[model samples]
Target: MLDTAQYRMAEGDTLPALLERYASAAKATEEAVAALPDLDVGVPLPRTPWSPPEPEVWSARRVLLHLIRETAQHAGHADLVRETLDGANTTAQR
Candidate 1:
């Protein structure tokens, strides 16, 4: 297994690349959350088909829009968790 120190990237890799990795790892969860109607803040997205088990994950239209929405959710959840644990809230309004 790779050690923690060795897992660190060298120079030239942007920070968002690291964040994107985390987002990618949580892909399924993000997609699931994104499919929820309330998750679409002011955006009237198409109604995604019910993601049934055994094969049908989600429709193509839902899949295409998932990445952006997923990443945003990751960022939001991270912020809240970090702030609460740190004993201080973020100044930036969500």
Candidate 2:
């Protein structure tokens, strides 16, 4: 019953810029998946094929899972980096 898209922030369309694009895409994937109803999880993806040997890219299901896993990884990195700068991992403390 719902669909979603998001803005992409980029540097200048190069390797370093690809970082922002990846982060943008990951964020967009997250938002789109979250907008779906539970029943939508196994349904076909809207923009891309859900099964692929064609592009060798992840499927929608895999994208969703990766978003979750990578969110945790990025959060951990943020926490660790923050700690290195100021001595804290706030989520761990709270």
Full-model lDDT for every candidate:
0.63, 0.63
List the candidate 1 regions with Cα displacement exceeding 4 Å.
1-51, 57-61, 92-94
Give all TM-scores, in the order shown: 0.34, 0.41
Q: Write the per-residue lDDT of candidate 1 for residues 5-84, one digit (tens) a residue.
A: 53468688788998797678678756766676653334333333443334434444565477668768989999999988
Clashing pairs in 1: none
In terms of lDDT, the poorest run of 10 residues in model 1 is 39-48
- lDDT, residue 71, candidate 2: 86
C-alpha RMSD for every candidate: 11.6, 9.5
lDDT for model 1 comes to: 0.63
Model 2: per-residue Cα lDDT over 23-79, one tens digit each: 897788668778877623554434433434444444567756765898899888888
